[model samples]
Target: MGGDHGLAVTIPAAVNLLRTHSHVFVHLVGQQVAIEQSLSRYRNLDPTRFAVVHANDVVTMDDPPAQALRGKKDSSMRVAINLVKEGVAQACVSAGNTGALMAIARFVLKTLPGIDRPAIATAMPTMHHGMSTVLDLGANVDCTAEHLLQFASMGSALVSALQGKMNPAVGLLNIGEEIIKGNDTVKQAAELLRQSNLNFYGNVEGNDIYKGTVDVVVCDGFVGNIALKASEGVAQLMSGTIRDEFQRSWFSRLCAVLAYPILRRVKRRLDHRRYNGASLLGLRGVVIKSHGSADAFAFECALVRAHDAVQNGLLEKITQAMVPLSAEADAA
Candidate 1:
């Protein structure tokens, strides 16, 4: 987990979560000082569940991930991934530098058969209909048409597994919903998707994301990141506005007390912590990314996600499915 504020909270949760698993040794890889401090603080934690393997150096959020991975030999990110590569750990989770996380995962785990670059993918609630997943959120701001196509393919497969939907509707994020809209990449991506073997539901506008128009929405990181942040902003702003309105009048204040249970429920629904982690799809191994600002409960949420991915063999399934799809790449 990211060693930010709330690490105290995350540590206990991690201890309890791992206590039930057998031989779950943790390699607490990060900048040397942080890892030691963290281990020392949690000395009384479950001895049977996690043994500490320390990493001294970690890339910070400010550093460029690709460059840092090459420059630092014992980076915490690399060390964690190397442990996984060497069979030391089944999986790893981090709330630290996301760029380094992606770079190291690629360098260590490499990509699966059909994967060019592993993309960060997450499921989010939508306005139009049911919840949907979005991919390449910040993995690649400038992407090729092929990249968008790959995201759609992988995103759909993941949603099918998690949501238990067969041939889930897939949509391309576009400015306009018409078949001939969007920039060159979006237009070309639409054309390619329609020809591909995966389910394609044509183009969808940003306004339509919550309408449940598609099971998975595909876009470059730039657009996807904007869409994600915008959604989060809107949810927060709406909640704040409602809270202020309730506090303004005596009757409304009384009503708020009456609606306290309902308000709490709404807050819980919008809690990003519950949806704190996302999968880095198309890697040889499974890598789960947690929010950088994640507290201990947030980290705990991420650890649970990693455990699930490990148990379910998410990497194995993606590899099996991707092998057949990206056969030409392997052949080449």
Candidate 2:
């Protein structure tokens, strides 16, 4: 809650959530006025449940990494990461400064063992049915074949954890179902994926994306981000169309009422914004990136995701499985 945008909406909404969930701890990072304002709004909050830290820094979108880190030591983003590092906080969630957030997370949280680069793994609604998780979603646009494999392993493990299964049946996001297709990186990644112990479902295409044809789709950040954004845009267009159709004349309005409950359910199920936060896998701690336009509800959902990731001990499981697998491969 530190950026130029005031915390008027976020702070109150967070406060109410704290009130409902007293077990949860809320930490505020911002200027004295903003922090104090939030605390005062939740004055009756249990002293132990809610805490405030006056941060001297706020990273803007335009600020380069070097500038954000060197220029703003007291910035809220930096301070938040520091708290995570020092064990004062389990994890820090931010809605501001994507580049800055990645920089701070890398700086403070550190990468998980054997992971050279962390990737953004997020759940997306599938057109075929249910939902699927995609990884390397803009965290790394360019990656080595090995890096893509890591994303596959990481995404597979995460999806399994979420879906309650030993293996969620992974798929490599590629230009074609044929293993031989795609550029050098994906081709090599496909070879490695085929060798992995995890459930590797070979390659999938953009058209196969929402088909719910695979549990996890792995791709480089560049393509993955484009796919994610395009899917979101399409979902939004569909929502608009449905709303327009429902709002027509009296008869249509009556039909809208008849279908209101089901349509609302469908809209909620399909809303991309609801699952906006993408977990930065391969990081020591759970760090989520939500949309810049995210509202308080989205922020709250992100918080829940962070909580779930930690509770699931996702990093621990992935690392436990990967380190040994790497060893076995080396020995072979």
Candidate 3:
């Protein structure tokens, strides 16, 4: 009961997921009556596969993170996270307020040992028809060199687990691919990454992200957030411009008709819905944040992400990967 459409979006997504994944169980954490009413719309849904865990309050999109954390303990977001903490749920996925979700998740589940801050990481479609995992996507606006290093470690582990890349290449996002191009902080982080056990691929420029130059791209939240939004804007612009051009005149319309098949394939490849879930890495429990504006298909993709992370033991992989970082810290 937290996103733009609340139960209207989530209930349908849950139904769709259950239809495809026979073994998955769902906990609908919201008002019981409303949840039941929504679930009643669909036909032939298995009752045993999903259950409603009622939550009294809701964290609105405008709610402050502190208020969501302290004032609304019974909000759907908080209660869902609590289920994860209590071992009743393996993971928690929310399309709620991003700030509130992060604050509540960090407070309730706590960060993993050796993690100073939890970073938001997500997979983006690359030019090579592959995916690149980028981290610190609006989680930490200001970061130390050590924090960037931590993001690299967690991101490598995330790709290794989800993408089946045993040793994912890691790159530090910078102004240029040259090592001497960034500020002191980035230079320091580069040195740290080079010294670490990760398979660091050195500095990468913004365009290299789309080129699939590395499996993991680590950057501070400010740069990462900007990059994400810019890429999204470009995708929308390209699709929209193509549609408008096709509708401008009869000749263009005829051309569009002839190119319809190719255009359809392009639209499918660039669909943002396919990449809706963003994992909150460095948390002890698996927590995924979905875009609040997501529709049913996009939300289902987020659910699939949660399932994939659980199946791959994301938490355990990150813990094991961090051991080397911890050892280095102890040695220092």
Highest-scoring model, lDDT:
3
- Residues 1-332 of candidate 3 have per-residue lDDT tens digits of 87898889999998999999899999999899999999888888888999999999999999999999999999999999999999999999999999999999999999999999999999888885798999999999999999999999999999988888989999999998888999988999999999999999999999888889999999999999999999888878887898999999999999999999998898788677898899999998999999999999999999999999999999999999889999999999
List TM-scores for all candidates, in order: 0.87, 0.90, 0.98
- lDDT (tens digit, per residue) of candidate 2 on 38-143: 5675446677776787886678778887788778888888887788788777767777777778887898789887677988888877774578888888888789
**Model 1 CA deviation exceeding 4 Å by range:** 1-3, 19-25, 30-45, 127-129, 249-252, 327-332
Residue 250 in candidate 2 has what lDDT? Answer: 89
Per-residue accuracy of model 1 over 1-332 as CA lDDT, tens digit each: 34464345555656656665555566555544554565576555655555556665657777788776888767667877888888788877877778888888988888887778788988776653267788889988899888888888788777766666778788999988898788998999898788777789988888766777788889999888888999889888998899899999999999999999998987776577877778888887768888887876667777777777777667766665565457644565
Candidate 3 achieves a global lDDT of 0.93
The TM-score, computed over Cα atoms with residue i paired to residue i, of candidate 2 is 0.90
Measured by C-alpha RMSD in angstroms, how accurate is candidate 2? 2.5
Best by TM-score: 3
Order of candidate numbers by TM-score, starting with the best: 3, 2, 1
Off by over 4 Å in 2: 2-6, 16-22, 127-129, 244-259, 328-332
Candidate 1 clashing pairs?
A: 10-296, 32-56, 126-210, 127-210, 127-211, 128-210, 128-211, 128-212, 129-211, 129-212
Candidate 1, backbone clash total:
10
